[model samples]
Every structure is written in C-alpha cells, then in structure tokens.
Target: MGNSFSELIKNFDKTRDYMRDFYIYGFKTRNDFQYKSLRTYDDERRRIESWLGDFIKFSNSKKGKQISISCDSSKIEENPLYNAYRCKSFTKNDIQLHFFLIDILEEDNFISLNDITDRILDEFEISFDPQTIRMKLNEYIKEGIIISRKQGRSLVYAKSPDSFQRLAGNDSDKITDMIKFFSESAPFGIIGNYILKSLDKLNNLFLIKHNFIVHTLEDNILLALCQAIEGKNYVSLVNYGKSHKKTEIKCIPMKIHVSTQTGRRYIIVYNKQWKRFSALRLDYIKSVDILEVCPEYDCYLEKYQKNAVYCWGTSFGAKRPKEGIEYIKMTLRIDEHNEKFIIDRLKREGRNGSVEKTGENTFCYYGEFFDVSELSPWIKTFTGRIIKLESNNKQVENRFYSDIRKMQKMYEVK
Candidate 1:
C-alpha cells in the first residue's frame, strides 16, 4: 500500500493550530513550524491542501517552500477555511453504514433497528450489529437527517423529510437572501453555506463589509460559550497562548464582544477567583467545558453590565485605580467646516467617550474608562489631527509618544 492515507483528520485542534500558523499568519515555511516534527508539518500541509486545494498556494522562498492560503473574500460566498472543521474522521464501516442506513430509510417509512439490521444483511449482504445500527440511527436523529418516534414499545426511525427543500420551494428568493446573509454574518455560518449549495444558489444579492472569515474557526467555541451564557452556567476553559501551555480558567460568561476594526471576537467573563471581569480572546480559548449553573449568575451579570461601560476595548485595566477610574483626553485639530465627519466619528465610534468643540476648528474627545491604554489604537487614528493627548496613566502618554517617535524614525520624518 502507498504511504498516504485519507486526508481527513481525527483531531481538529491540531489541524486548527497548524492552519492558524500557516493560513492566518501566512507565508510559513516548513522549517518555520519548529515546534512540530517535519513529518507532522508535511502531513498537515497535505491535509490543508486536500481540504482547500483551490485556495492553497505556495511559492519558493529562501528558507523553503512558503505555504499560504490565498482567497478573495469578496468573490467567495462562504469562507473556505471552515471546511477544515467539517473534515471529520471516518472508518470503512462508517462510510458503509452511513450509506446503508440512509438508503434503508430513504424509502420514507419508519423502520425498527432490528429491521434495519436485517435489511442490511438481506439487501446489501452486509451485517451490522443491531446496536451499531441503533447508534448510527441515533446520531442521524440528532443531526436531523433522520427522525425517530415511539412505535408500540420500541422506537422506529425514518429519514427526515427535506425541510430545506420545502422552504426553498415556497420562497426561493427570500430564503436565498436570508441564507446568504446568515452564511456571511452569523456564527456557525458554514451551515448556511451548505444550505446554499443544496439549493444550488449563489450569494449574488448582498455584499457584506467587515466580515471576519477567520472567526468561523471559533464557531464551535462560540456555540459552547453562548450556550453557557444563555443558561447562566459557569464554564471551565482551556486557554492556550504563545507557549502552548494550557491554563484552565473557571468563569461566568457575560457577553461576546467583537471588534469592528480587526473583527476579533472576545468573551467578557467574570473570573470569580480573581474577583474581576475580563475579556478572553475567543481564538485563544482551546476548549470549553460547561460547568454547573452559577448561583450568582444574575448578580455577576448585573455587575458585568456596569463594568462593561468602563471597558474601552477588551482590557479592564491591569491596575484598578483606587478611585475605580482612569481617563483620556485628546485634543484634535479638525477643520470645523470641512471635517465635521471627524467629530461625527468621535461620537459614533468613541463608545462612552464624549466629544466637544473646545475652540475654533479644535475638538476635545475625552472618556473615563478602566484602562486608558485600551483606547490608544483609536487615539492613533487621528495622528495628524492630534493637538495633544493627556491621560492619568504616564505609561499611556509615554507609549503614544514612543510609538509616534518610532513611526517618525521609520518614515524618516524630521
């Protein structure tokens, strides 16, 4: 037999980790992946190519062949990266049983597990144990591919009627529009993409801006976190960072926060042990285990709502002030007549920040937050227009000037 087996993966986390390194980070040569073995890297590269052959591109680099994912987000209806998650592992019997069971139930009649086992033996000349058949049926039932109902004492399973087909038949245009929107905008949107494929439809109607395609990889994580948040349940999450050391954290999930600039997603949670609320990056979260429902869920949620107002971006400041506050004030040189949009943006995108006209063609934008540093990126957007920047934290003020000086030196500005 040849060395290569099926490209499908058994462990998604390993694939996801490698994918982020090569695909998201991009231009990673084989040698760049030093943590993993060369063989393992090659296998993962091959697997990624198998799943996203069209989008996978490589070029010769000084170090080695630089692997990267290349795709035009605007042209694509769905993110191709999501296919990584769908590449589930299967055995020979799994494929065989899947077809056998579906074919048996495609008749649209309810059949018992024993009946299925017998049919497989007589019709397909293959014998699957009744228990194995039952398990497969249960899985299909959960997936909505099959439906089970009580028939006398035992249960009977039947292939589920095509709900998508029926819905598409009634309002094809509306359904197409909705699916197109959902596939691009919503979490676990790849399902919408699958539905669109089934309908033989394309997303020709809408153009989405600021769609974060990478966020789809974290959809499974989001689903678990959202479910826990909905149920007021505490969750234990395995958060992995640069060192890849797993740190387990137990917290009460409050809300999901998405950045408009980078399209990154974060879950704001109340860390009971720390007695503080913090936002954890969704991408960094390796796994989430739903724990028991929080008894103080409501109280924590209320406290979080108040705490959220102080959150400028995601960081709730490293050092909570004695007065429980930090502040930032930025003076901008806006042409009051021509640059009203600048003032408008300050009001629109500033969150809890206040913008006021201080003098002729000058505006002051100020906000009180838990962390002044969190607003630095937004502060930098008005680089040329910034007359002065003041903050209670000296580090925040120093860092702004430090970054400005670095940029000036890089650009060779006097």
Candidate 2:
C-alpha cells in the first residue's frame, strides 16, 4: 500500500524483519548486529515486545543482554504478527476527525471542505484548520475510506457507498454461506471478515481444522511475486540466509511452490549471477520488488526442469548436476486383496510413479528423479513391502540401510 499505512499504528508488519530475524536467531549481545543502528534495533525490539510480550524473554550473561522469543510457533492458532497487525492505534486528532466527518457524511450527502471544518468547530468545539481538514480528507479519499467529488466548481466529500447495500436483495443465505467458507479459507480472508461479521447467522459455523493464519501476512508479498512471475520479470529480493545474515539478490522469479504436507510456501527464482535455480522460503523472504520484464527468464527453467525431478524439497541448490539427476526404480510386494488401502495410498501419494504387477502379489514402481534420496522417507513407509530398491546413486541405498540399522539397534537396546 501507501506510506500512510503501518506508521499510523505501531503494527507488527512494520517491524517484521526486526522481530523474525531475532526470533529465529536471537541476539547474544547488543553489538553483534546486522541492523543499521542500535537505535533502530531498540525501536523495533520495543515494538515487537508490545505485541509479543508474552513470548519475549531476556537473559544476562558474558555475551551481554540477550533477547529471544520463547514459543512453540506451530501450535499457535493465529500468527502473533497478524494479531499485532490488526491492532490499530490512533492519535487524538484521528479519533475526532473520524467522528466529525463520518457523522455528517453518514446521511450520504456530499459537502465541501469548508463546511466540514466549520461543522467540527461550530457543532463540536473542536477547532481544526480548514487546510489541515482538506489534507486529512484527501488521505481518506486516496485510501477509499471516503469519497471526494467536484460538484461544479466546489469539491465535496462523503463516506464511500456501502457495498453491503447492493448485496442486500440477493439470495442472502447462499451468499452468507459462500462468504463464511471463503472468509475462513481463502488467503487474506481478513479482507472478507467485515462482510462475514455483518451476517450474524454465519457466525461460528466454520471450525477450520487446518487454518494457516500466518499465510495472511504473506499475501501482499505473494501477490507481488506472482505478478512478477506471470509477467516474466526479474525481482530484487532482500532475504536472509541460513546464517541469519541479510543479503540482496537480483533473480528471475520462475514459479511458486507449496508443500502439501506442511502448507509452507516458496518461490523458485533463477539467480543469473550464480547461473542456477534457488528456492527462497516465502516466510524468510523479507520483501520483493518487481524489476523490468526479462525475455530470457524461461530459458533458466529449461535447465531447472531437468534438475527439478531430483528436488525432494525446494533445495534445487545454486548449480546443477554434481547434484546429479538419476533414475530411481523400486519393486513393492503388495497383496491386492489384503492391501487395497496401501495400494490406493501409494497411487495417491506417488506424484508420477508408474505401478505394474511383476508377480502374483508384487508390484513394480518406476520413476525418474534427480535425487532418489528424497523418496527415502516414503520408501521407508513400505519397509517390509520393499523387496527390491535400486537407484543409480549407491549412496542413497546405503543411507537407507544405515537408517534402518540405526533404528533396529535403538529398538533392540530398548
């Protein structure tokens, strides 16, 4: 959005990087910092504490005063950042101006800037300057919170028309149901929350089992990234590495990928300087700016696709094929009559694994992947059923046995 947002309130999104970096990688000492200034860190730390006071902790040691967040983030129903983002703070002038302007404009009648300022002074004892009121109203108009129109030579203002009024005559029951489902389910569901709240009948109907509330914070960045990807444009990303250090990179954003298991999201970008594909975790991505459209972006994907088959996670890495692309094939012994469930699950979870019967109760699976090691966990699920497992990479097969032996030794000792 515009500069007017976030600053008006001591919001969490404003101090996002300050809190997240520190939360993930806490400060052992005040001076050991990547932030520009100590004053900047103090300001942001205080802002973060205001929202996450419950989770904040401090310690005194040889490393000086250390700050860290203590919470099991996965268990939280809503992201605390979202809760703070929703926390709206206002100045004394903001409160008075809203009431003075809204009370007059509630009737849907438009009036000039002079009339509004006069109404505040004469009707409410609040003496606000006419020029100041005009500027304030202009900000509201830009935000679409209020409407300003030129009625002949004089400019007039009013509260923007209610969209609810247009939907009032339609099939309300159906509309309310649709609104309830989407408001709880869609990204930026908060945007639809106001409308959903208006329909009291729809309240508390949805008890989402797997709501990813933190995804709401990523909506703006995701939109920008997706827009750049669709337009085939380069983007400048300010991101943090595993070391919790800041770095900026210019890359062509090729695609967005999400994990079905965890619902974590990532953007796969091709780094021209490194001449390879790198997947940036969307949660770790601080900000993105779409650069000019690039014609050669898709050419990077041609190389990426060859390697993507081996990518078990978003770790496509900085270069190709010392991280070799290989063929992986396996044979599982599944009795058709007794193991319909296992057979169905294998088919459902297998992205592109081909299934064929090689013997009476045995089935063969064939697939090509860059890294067969990635499929180890899924392969382990079929422990007894895996009669034969072969791959071009010998290390993968050896690691699988090593894991199984370690597990056996632990259980035997127990």
Cα RMSD of all models vs. native, in order, equals: 2.2, 5.9
Predicted candidate 1, C-alpha RMSD: 2.2
Q: Output the lDDT of residue 412, model 2.
A: 98
How many pairs of residues collide in model 2?
2
Tens-place lDDT per residue, model 1, 97-166, is: 9888878885368888888899999999987778887888888889888998899999988888876766
Error of 1 at 369 (Å): 0.8
lDDT of each: 0.84, 0.73
Model 2, 1-414: lDDT tens per residue? 334323225544555555555566675457766456876666666666777778888888787888876666445533455544556787788788877787877437888888888888889988898887887898888877799778999999889885565556577677776676676667666655656554544434555655555566677778889899889899998887778789998999877887756667889988879877778888878789999989887677676676676676676632565555666678888889999888888787777677778989888887766567768878898887888888887987888778878988988945
Which 10 successive residues of model 1 have the least lDDT summed?
Answer: 315-324
- The most accurate candidate by TM-score is 1
